[model samples]
Target: MAEAFERGGQQAWFHDHGHWGVFFHTYDNFQLSGFGEHFDQPRKIHVFIPRDYEVSPDRYSVLYCNDGDDIFFGDGETEQSWQVAEKLSQLYLRDQLKKIIVVAICSGDRHYEYSHIPEDDGGLEEYSRYLAKGLKPFIDENYRTIPHSTVILGASRGGLAAFYTACKHPRQFPQVATLSPSFWLGLDSPSYSMSNLDKAFKIKLQNSALMFALTSTLLEPDLRPKIYLDWGLRDDPGNEYEIRSQCRCMEMIQVLTTEFDYQEDHNLFIVEDPNGSHSINSWGDRLPNILQLFFD
Candidate 1:
């Protein structure tokens, strides 16, 4: 059963960045409406504001990202951080991209919370409601965000979460970027064998959040969010499982283009990185392009 869509009236306070960096404001142990009942604990929310945000009167587009610790403030050397502040600073300084605010939601029990399909034991729908009904409104109320101009992004399992959230709540997130998403998740087997490729593909297509959203009579094509997908050709090197997963990703892209009529270089953007790997660095490397595609 789906939980009631509700928002916590509790106010969250932001603290100094301290070691994180200048552009970030940290909100520790921030509790969302339904998260306490559904999740393990309150999540740490990080907001990245543009450098001149205070002086400027202009509102900014918002980027909501999963895996806050990895994306926003992981240590530079040991951890493969996305370096969102670094990249955003550079882009803003160069005037290459629009001024944007980033809201990073930290993960807790990520494997469970990020799962999309019913076969997977998780609170994906609850999590999605938390974002759409909980976080977005909070951010809008406190921050100067341009209405209806929000994008959600994530990689791997986080990518799956982002995709599902955007599909379920398109009005809240009109643009979404998924890097090497784990679409093969929740299948009978974690990895697909060559002989069972067809079966896996059918199951995925039938159960896909994107498919459900698009096929619905209520959703118009224009209301569908712009989708960006990227995958590394060398994600798992010679592993047969990774290769088959990559093939599935390609098939999904094809279906989006041919069946859904999502035009390339427009609503749909795909990148196949030959040198990319299934790691934070690779996703970080590709993020700049995504930012440009959506915000520039």
Candidate 2:
């Protein structure tokens, strides 16, 4: 496979031209790896271009998906996948959605890179920089995409990454979809060095609530990205982790509705599925609805 572009694009494979819409491209490294970086693994980017891309001169909207592994191919850890390319193709064929490009950015150290806890091995700052600064510029330069039409999306840890990235860089990602986000992770105290573990939990929740308030305040009221958040009621069933996560998710929803002043079914859309769980398949099942909510 030859390097596809000046920056580090290597074509993963070639398909019969104009037949399949999905294309795979790999980068040698996440761009700007030397600037206070820790995770610098090879990046695999899967792009889904609508079939009309070649036939029409029109530029399409872009959807920047995290967890590229779960998007088309399972991450090799499970037999589940989102098949996002196939879904977009179906929607395009049915004329139910406007043409859009899907840019799925695969994860490296998923837990570390997707985390917001800067005190931990969290590399979210670097990872989001790669998305908003590095990858977006590269994609825009290479593809016929609509300017400022990018939306970020993910599930689980990737969901946390997407939400944080959008909140921090709303201009780059003006819309976001977070499905079954691991909100429990954020609920825990970010500091491992804290002396009191019990008090840390309460303090963390209070601080997190305050952080959300600050998050809303920092984001210009007009520039706040449209947010789509969802979680399954039975995410982990009997697991305490899921219980905390669901509670935290609801709490964040409350903050967004009240503090952020987001109107339901308008700029803010949330879904609570009674039967939904924290699995790739569950997130996959909910993806089309998310796409419809944002892109349709």
- The count of residue-pair clashes in candidate 1 stands at 0
- Where is the poorest 10-residue window by lDDT in model 2? 10-19
> Stretches of candidate 2 above 4 Å error?
1-13, 16-35, 39-41, 189-206, 209-219, 235-242
Question: Who wins the TM-score comparison?
Answer: 1
TM-score of every candidate: 0.84, 0.83
Each prediction's Cα lDDT score?
Answer: 0.74, 0.71
RMSD of each: 5.9, 4.5
Best by lDDT: 1
Q: Going through the candidates in order, what is the number of backbone clashes in each? A: 0, 0
Assess candidate 2 and give its lDDT: 0.71
